[model samples]
Target: MNRFEDKIAIVTGAASGIGRATADRLRSEGGTVVGIDRDPVDDVDMAIQLDLLDLGAIAPTVAQIVDAYGRIDVLCNVAGIGHFARDEDETPEAWNRVIGVNLTGTYFMSQACLPHLLESQGNIVNTASTAGTNAQAWSSAYSASKGGVIALTQTMAITNGRSGIRVNCIAPGGVETPIGEQFTPPEDVDLTLMAGMLPYHRPAQPPELASAFAFLASDDASYCNGIVLRVDGGTMA
Candidate 1:
C-alpha cells in the first residue's frame, strides 16, 4: 500500500477528475505528488498552474519540480481534451486543440520528465481511452490523439525498458468525469454509430481509474512496460 513511500510524482490535470483522484491516491500512499493543471489544484502536496498546450512551459515546470522535490519517480500524463462532431462539422481549430493537448502535450511532458525518471528508474502511466483501440464515431480527434498516446507509450517503453524506465497506458472505457461535457455530439449525429461505444457496466468513477494508474506507477508492475491495460468493463473484449 505504501509503494510510493518516499517517491515523487508529477500528475497532469490534477485539478479535477481522474487526475485529482490519482494525485490523492498517490499522496495517500506516501508519494509527494506535484499537481499540474491550468486550474488551481489545492489537494496535492505541491500545485503548479500549467496549461499543457503551452509546450514551452513544460521544461520549466519540470525543472521547478526537480528543484523542489530533488527527483521525480513517476510521471502521469493524464491531461487531455476531446471534441466530437461529424466529419464535416469538425473544424481545424478543434482538431488541433484536441491533438495538441492530448498527443503533443503528453509527448513533451514525457520528454521533459524522462531524464529524471531515468535517474530514478521510474515509470509513466498515461491515460489513453477505449476509443483509441476501438473506433468510436464522432470522436475522430479524440481517438486519433489517444491512439497516438498508446503508440507513444509503447515506443517509450521499448526505448527505455532496458535502461530501467517502464511506460504503460490505461485504455479506459467511460469514466464519470467532466470531460464528457466537452464532447457533446452534434445534434444531428447518428445515435447508432456511438451506441456500441457504451460500456457493459456503468461508467467507472474517478477513483476506479486512479487505482489502475497507481498500480502501473508502483514497483509492483516492474515488468508491465509497453502494455495497454484496458480498464473498460469488457467493452472491447
Candidate 2:
C-alpha cells in the first residue's frame, strides 16, 4: 500500500476535489506531499498558497520545494477550472481564464519542475478529461484545455522518457466536487455534462480518480509513459 513510501510529491489544486483527494492518497500511501493551491488545504506535509495562473510565482515555488525536499519524485498537475458556457456566451476573459489555469498553468508548473525531475529521474501525472476526448457539450473551454493537456503529457513523456522520466495523463469524466454545489450550466446545454455520458448514471468521486493517479505515478506503471489513462467509468467507451 505504501507505494510512494518516503517519496516527495507536488500536487496542485490540493485545496479541493481531485487534487485534494490525490494529496490525501499520496500521504496515506506514505509520500511527503507538498500541496499547491490558491486556497488553504489541510492534511498535507506542506501547503503552499499559490495561484497557478500566476506564472511569475511558479519557478520560485518549485525552487522552494527543491530547497526544502532536496528532490521531487512526482508532479501531479491537477489544478483546473471549469464551467458551462455556450460558444456565444464565452467571452474573451472567460476563455482565457479556463485555458490559463488548466493548460498554461500545467505547462509552466511542469516546466518549473522538470529540471529537478530530470535530476531525480521522476515522473508526472497530468489531469485531462473525457471532455477533451469527446464533445463536452457547453464547456468548450474546459474541453479544449484538457485536450491540450493530453498533447502536453504525451510530448513530455516522449521528450523525457530517455532521461528516465515517465509522463502520463488521466482523463476523468464528470466527477462530484465542491464545484458541483453551484453547477448551474446554461439552460440550453445538454444535462449530461452535469451527469455523465455513461451507463453509470452518477458522477465519479474524487477519490476514484485519485486512485488512478496514484497508479500512474507509481512504480507499478514504470512502462506507462505517454499513456492516456481514462478513468471515465465507461463515458468514453
Candidate 3:
C-alpha cells in the first residue's frame, strides 16, 4: 500500500480529472505530492496555479518543488489539452494551444525536472492517449501532440537509462474524466452506436487509469523503461 512511501512526486494538471486522480492516488500510496495546474485545487501538499503554455513558468515551478521537497522522486507529465477540431477547421491558435500544453509543456517540465530526477534516480510517467498510437478523426492536434509525448518518453528513457532514471508512457483510451465528458456525442450522435467500438462497452474510470500510473511509478515497474503501457481496457487490443 505504501509503494511510494517517503517519495516526493510532482503531478501536473492536478486541478481535476485524471491528473487529480493520479495525484490523490500517489499520495494515498504514500508519495508527498506537489501538484501544479492553471486552476486551483485543494488536498495537494503543495498546489501551484501555473499555466503550462507559458514555458517560462516551468523552471520556476520545478525550482519551487526542489526548494520544498529537496528532490523529486517521481514526475508525472499529465498536463494536456484536448482538441476536437477537424484538420481544416483547426486554427493556428488552436493548434498552438493544444501542442503547447500537451507537447511543449511536457518537454519543458521534464527538462526542468531532469536534474532533480537524476539526483533521485527517479521515474517519469506521462499520460499519453490511444490517439497517439492510432489516428483519431477530428482530433489531429491532440493526436499529434500525444504522439510527440510517446516519442519523447522513449527518447528520455533511452537517454537517461544509464543514469538510473526511468521514463514511460501510458496511452489511455476514453476515460470518464472532464476531457472524456467533452467528447460526448452531440444530441444527434448515437450513444449506442459509439458503444460498439470499445471492447469494454464503456468509458474507463479515472481511478482505473490512475492505478496504472501508480504501478508504473512504483518499483514494481523497475524494468518498464521506454515502454508505452496502454490503459485502454482492451480498446486497443
Candidate 4:
C-alpha cells in the first residue's frame, strides 16, 4: 500500500471536500502532498494559497513546489467552482469564471507541471463530472467546463503517454461536497428534466472520489491512460 512511498503530489482545491480528502488519502498512503487552494488548507506537507483564476501565478507556484520537492510524481487538478442559474439568467462573467477555474486552470497547471512530471515519469488525475457526459438542467457552464476537462484529460494522455507520463480523469456523479451544497437549482427549474441525473444511491462522499483519484494516480493504473473513469452510480446507465 506504500505505492507513493517516495512520491510527491500537488492537489488543487485542497482546502476542503474532495481536494482535502484526496490530499489526505495520498498522504496516508505515503506520499508527500502539497495542498493548494484560494482558502487556507490544512493537513498537508505544504499549503499553497492560490486562486486558479490567477493564471499568471500558476507556473510560479509549480516552480516553488518543484524547488522544494525537487520533483513531482502526481498532480491532482481538483479545484473547481459552479452554481446553477437559469440559462436566461446566467451571465457571461459567470460562464467565464467557471471555465476559467475548472478548464483553463487544469490545463495550465498541467502545462506548468509537465516538465517535472516528464522527468519523474509521473501521472495526473483530473476531476471531471458525470454532468460532463450527461445533460442536466441549469448547468450549461458547469457542463461545458467539465466536458472540456474530459477532452483535455484525453488529449494530455495522448500527448504525454509516450513520454512516460500518464493522464487520466474521473467523472464523478453527485458528491457530498461544499460545491454540491451550494448548488441551488434555479427556482423555476424543471424537476423531471433532472430525474435521470440522480444516482442509484446517495451522493458519493469525498473520500470515495479520492480513492478513485488515488487509483488513477498510482502505479496500479500504469496502463489506465487517456480514460475517463466514471465513478457515478450508474447514472449514465
Candidate 5:
C-alpha cells in the first residue's frame, strides 16, 4: 500500500494528536513527511519547530521543506488550539490567539505551500470541526476559526482546481486529543447544550480520523475538491 511511495508531504501540528497520526499514516504508506509544530517533537522524517502565530516563519518554513524535498505533494493543516471561556470571560488576547493559530495559520501555510502543491498537482487537507457547522457550548472562538477554515477550503478549492491542485477539509466532531481535552468549561458553565452535540458519545481515536486524512490526500480522491468530509460519527447527520 505505497499510495505515496514517492510523495513528499508537510503536516503542521505534527507534534501530536491528529497531526501526528496523519504524519504516521502517510509515512507508513511510503511518503516522506516533514512535520511542523510549535513545540518540540520528533515524529517525522524532518521536524521543524514552528509556532503558527509567527506569520513571518511561514514562508521560510515552506521554502525549507521544498528545498529539502524538491517537491511537495501534500500539506495537512492539523495543528490548532481550543478555547473554552464564558462569554464575558473571553478576552481579546485569547480570541486573537485562537484565530491566529487555527484560521490564520491554516491560511498562511496554504499560501506558502501552494506553489509547490501546484507543481506536483498535490492537495491540501485542512482540519475543520463539527463545531464550525454545528453549535458548541463553550467554543465561540474555536468554532469561528473552524468555520472560517471551511470557507477557506472552499475558496482554495475553487481557485486552485483549474491549476490541478485540490483543497478539501475534514470536519471532525469529537476526536480524542490534547486539544480536545483542552475544552474545559468552567464549573458554572452548563454542559447541556454540548451533550446533544455528539451522536456517537465517544471521541474518535487519532488514528481513526487519520484514515480520512489519508483518503483525501490520496489519488483515490482525485475528483474530490472543496468537499468537507465529516468524520463525526453522525454528529452532523
Candidate 6:
C-alpha cells in the first residue's frame, strides 16, 4: 500500500473525480501530492488554482513544484473539458477550448515536468478516454482532443523510453464523476435504450479507474509504455 512512499506526484484536474481519487490514493500510499486545478478543492498537500488552458501559468507552476519538492516522480495529466455540441453548432471557440485543455495543456504540463522527471527517471500517465478510440455522438471535439493525447503518450514513450521515463495513457469509459454527471441524459432522454447499449449497464466508479492510474504510474508497470489501457468495464468490448 505504501508503494509510493517518499514519491512526489503532480496530478492535474485534482479538484474532483478521478483526479481527486488518485491524489487521495497517492497520499494514502505515502506520496506527497501537488494538486492543480481551476476550481478550489480541499484535502491535498498543496492545491493550486490555475486554468490549464493558460499556457503562461504552466512553467511557473512547475517551477513552484520543483522549488518545493525538489523533484517530481510522477505527473498525471488529468485536466480536461468535455463538449456535447451538435455538429453545426460546434464553434471554433468550443473546439479550441476542449483541445486546449485536453491536448495542449497535457503537452505544456509534460514539457514543464520533463526536466524534473528526467532527473528522477520517473513516469507520466495521461488520462485519455474511450472516446479517443471509439466514436461518441456530439463529442467530436472531445474525442479528437483525447485521440491527440493518446498520440502524445505514444510519442513520449518512444522518445523517452531509453531515458528511463515511461509514458502511458488511460482510456476510460463512462464513469461516475462530476463530468460524467454533466453528460448524463436529460429526463426526456430514454435510459432504457442507453442501458441496453452498454455492456455494464452502468457507469464505472472513480476509484475503479483511479486504481488503474495508480498501477500505470507505479513501478509495477515498468515495462508498460506507449500503450492505452482501457478502463471501460467492457463497454468498449
Error of 3 at 43 (Å): 0.5
Clashing pairs in 3: none
Better of 3 and 4 by TM-score: 4
Candidate that beats the other on lDDT, 3 or 5, i.e. the better one: 5
Best-to-worst lDDT order: 4, 1, 5, 2, 6, 3
TM-score, per-candidate, Cα-based:
0.98, 0.94, 0.93, 0.98, 0.97, 0.93
Model 1 lDDT tens row, 82-191: 78888878899989999999999999999999999999999999989998998988889999999999999999999999999999999989888999898787897678
RMSD of 3: 2.3
- Candidate 1 Cα deviation (angstroms), residue 192: 1.1
Off by over 4 Å in 4: none
lDDT per residue for candidate 6 within 1-237, as digits (tens), equals 887898999999999999999898888888899999999967989899999888999999999989998999999998887777666677999899999999999999999999899999999999999889877666788889999999999999999999999999999988878886445443453356454335465788888888898999999999999999999888878
* lDDT (tens digit, per residue) of candidate 4 on 87-179: 899999999999999999999999999999999999999989988988878989999999999999999999889998999999999888889
- Model 3, poorest ten-residue lDDT window? 181-190
State the TM-score for model 3. 0.93
The lDDT for every candidate, in the order shown, is: 0.92, 0.89, 0.87, 0.92, 0.91, 0.88
Report the C-alpha lDDT of model 2 over 1-237, residue by residue, as the tens digit. 999997999999999999999999999999999999999988899999998878999999999998999999999999988867878878989889889999999999999999888988889999998878887677788889989999999999998899999999999877988865433578666666655544365679999999999999899998999999988777667
lDDT of 2 at 89: 79
Deviation of model 6 at 14, angstroms: 0.7
Decreasing TM-score order of the candidates: 1, 4, 5, 2, 6, 3
TM-score, candidate 5, is 0.97
**Candidate 6 ranges beyond 4 A from true positions:** 184-199
